[model samples]
Target chain A: MFYFILDILGTIAFAISGVMVAMDKKLDVFGVFIVAFVTAVGGGTLRDVLIGQTPLFWLKDLTYIVTIIGAVIVAVVFRSRMSYFKRSLLLFDTLGIGLYTLVGVEKGLAVGLSPIMCVALGTITACFGGVTRDILCNEIPVIFRREIYATACILGGFGFFILRQLPLEETYSYATAILIIIVIRLLAVKFKLALPNIYKST
Target chain B: MFYFILDILGTIAFAISGVMVAMDKKLDVFGVFIVAFVTAVGGGTLRDVLIGQTPLFWLKDLTYIVTIIGAVIVAVVFRSRMSYFKRSLLLFDTLGIGLYTLVGVEKGLAVGLSPIMCVALGTITACFGGVTRDILCNEIPVIFRREIYATACILGGFGFFILRQLPLEETYSYATAILIIIVIRLLAVKFKLALPNIYKST
Candidate 1:
């Protein structure tokens, strides 16, 4: 139940971000729809493919597709009121990052991947879709450049692992993971935090 | 030995196609290199993942990376001369489609996939990267709108399947596949052929 709610929230966040990015490119409705679909579903699709899941995730869940369409409709209809939504984007995005991290971690565990592999998968699930979206939009991914994006995911996965090891219930562990990710992301944004780039001028 | 030669030729064709697409985007030298790398190897990577091949194609053969880098250098140094090269892009692209189709079919057959799935994989191998490139560049996929792109690949795959049942050797079978794809594509271009859109006006 928690996972389902978080998943939808994450989808909404990614959809809005995608719509915003398409707007930057001055794309039309179809273009916006494509971007939104890609942003919301791209990471999970990649993860599923890597895990050799057949038919892919969206094929299994109609709700995800419907949510993205809903997001695009909402964005388009509320274009005049977009400015008011700007301040809320960060909060929504943080919520998304946390939820998505948990999803990746849980999926990785379900597949019996090692803790290290699970963490990597969690990070990939949280960040790679945005990376793909930015790459397709002809820009470097913001997660790669700023805001401690993958780091937040890693911490969230660790939180899940630690909480699971304790005497806490499954819901408590899951909530802790999401909270850890969301709080870390929010703080990073509030404090203007970033990871050091691996590539530097020689 | 013929498959080896055809593979190299196909890589070169793919590399050139990637460079030409990058040129269309007016990307800088590094941008062209990255785009070339992605374009030439993206489909193969996806294939490997779907087939449960670990570590991926380019990761196994570093030669693919070297080939793309070499193509990028040739493209950058001859940017002005690349205009003349555009005339050959279609031919190279067609050759690439044919060769990749053969590779996809052979790989799928090796993995014991159904003939229908093999044909689909062949089409994916031939056109998925270009679709990806167009999507990233904020345009509708050329494969989606263009005249008979995947159709040519399907035809080539069918040619391979038929030739395999004949008295011909594997090399001839492969050559027949390539010839079928190239001829069909060239004729399609010459005749201005197209598929009818399924979505009619509302």
Candidate 2:
């Protein structure tokens, strides 16, 4: 039940971020909606596809559609106050990724994927939405260049696996995984931790 | 049988194009291979996912991986002479999209999607590889801003449906549809026919 709520919150958070980027790019309303929808679901969709899951999670459930629409409306109405809301938005976004990483890892394990593949899926789920959003908006994906986003997810996935081997309850292990992701992300942003540039510009 | 050969050729063309882009961006070897692989199979993978097909077309086949690797190696070895091969590459690419459009439309129809959705799938399959390629390379999708690329695929899709309704042989109708797409694309490039800008610059 908590996971379900966290999934919805993450979808809204991702959709809002997508809206912000689309608006910044001056996309048409249709384009904006498309971008937002892709941002909210792209990661999970990719993971589902990779695992041979059919119809996709969003297509099977209309709630995601409704939530994205609500997010779009909210973003449009509060466009003027977007800058001021950045910190709060970031908080939601962080929590969203935290929850999503655990969800993705669990799904991978359920499907009997290898441990490494499970971690990769978790990272992909947490980061690919923003990557798709930036691509549609015609920018380099911020996660590829910015502070430790996907890395935190990777670490959290590892943590989830490690904690699961302990004698603790599944819920506690999951919560610990989520917490590890959230704390890592918060620290990364707070301290400006980032991966080194892969390509050195001449 | 013919479709299989055309699909492989298309994969090679797209992979070569991806290698060119990655090299231009100065990405490392791993990045180059990744970009190439995505460019070759990204479109069909997306089409398959959307239509509830899974395991992805490329994953089930090893030929695609080998073809992309060969293309990448050739691209790197012949980097300095790429400009001279542009005409040949363009020819192969045109054929690739023509064949891919029909393949996508056929797949969609086979899955019992609506006619309009089938056409959309055709356009996506023919063009989205380049879109993914550009996105991974951190550029605006050339399709979104450029010439009549996707338009050709849409027109070809309609042509397929129209021809299917006639008394023509199945092979003839399919051939006609592919020919229409190739001719339209060739003419568009030759005459520089392009869609009007969505956003008029001040």
The ten-residue window of minimal lDDT in model 1 chain A covers A53-62
- Stretches > 4 Å off in candidate 1: A28-30, A196-202, B1-19, B22-127, B131-202
- The DockQ leader among the candidates is 2
Q: Could you tell me how far off, in angstroms, the CA of residue B96 lies in candidate 1 after the best superposition? A: 11
List per-prediction Cα lDDT, in the order shown.
Answer: 0.76, 0.84
Classified by CAPRI criteria, candidate 2 counts as incorrect
Give one digit per residue, the lDDT tens place, for model 2 in B131-181.
889888887676655577888888989998988998989889889999999
lDDT of 2 by residue, A1-202 (tens): 7778888888999998988887777665545666788899899888887887875666546688789989988887777777788888888899999988877888899999888988998888888999988878777789888769999999998998899899999999889988999999999999988988876675
Please give the fraction of native interface contacts (Cα pairs under 8 Å between A and B) kept by each candidate: 0.06, 0.25
Name every residue pair that clashes in candidate 1. Answer: A136-B136
DockQ (CA atoms), all models: 0.08, 0.16
Give candidate 2's error at residue B85 in angstroms: 1.4
Where model 2 places Cα greater than 4 Å from the true spot, the runs are A1-53, A56-131, A139-202, B200-202
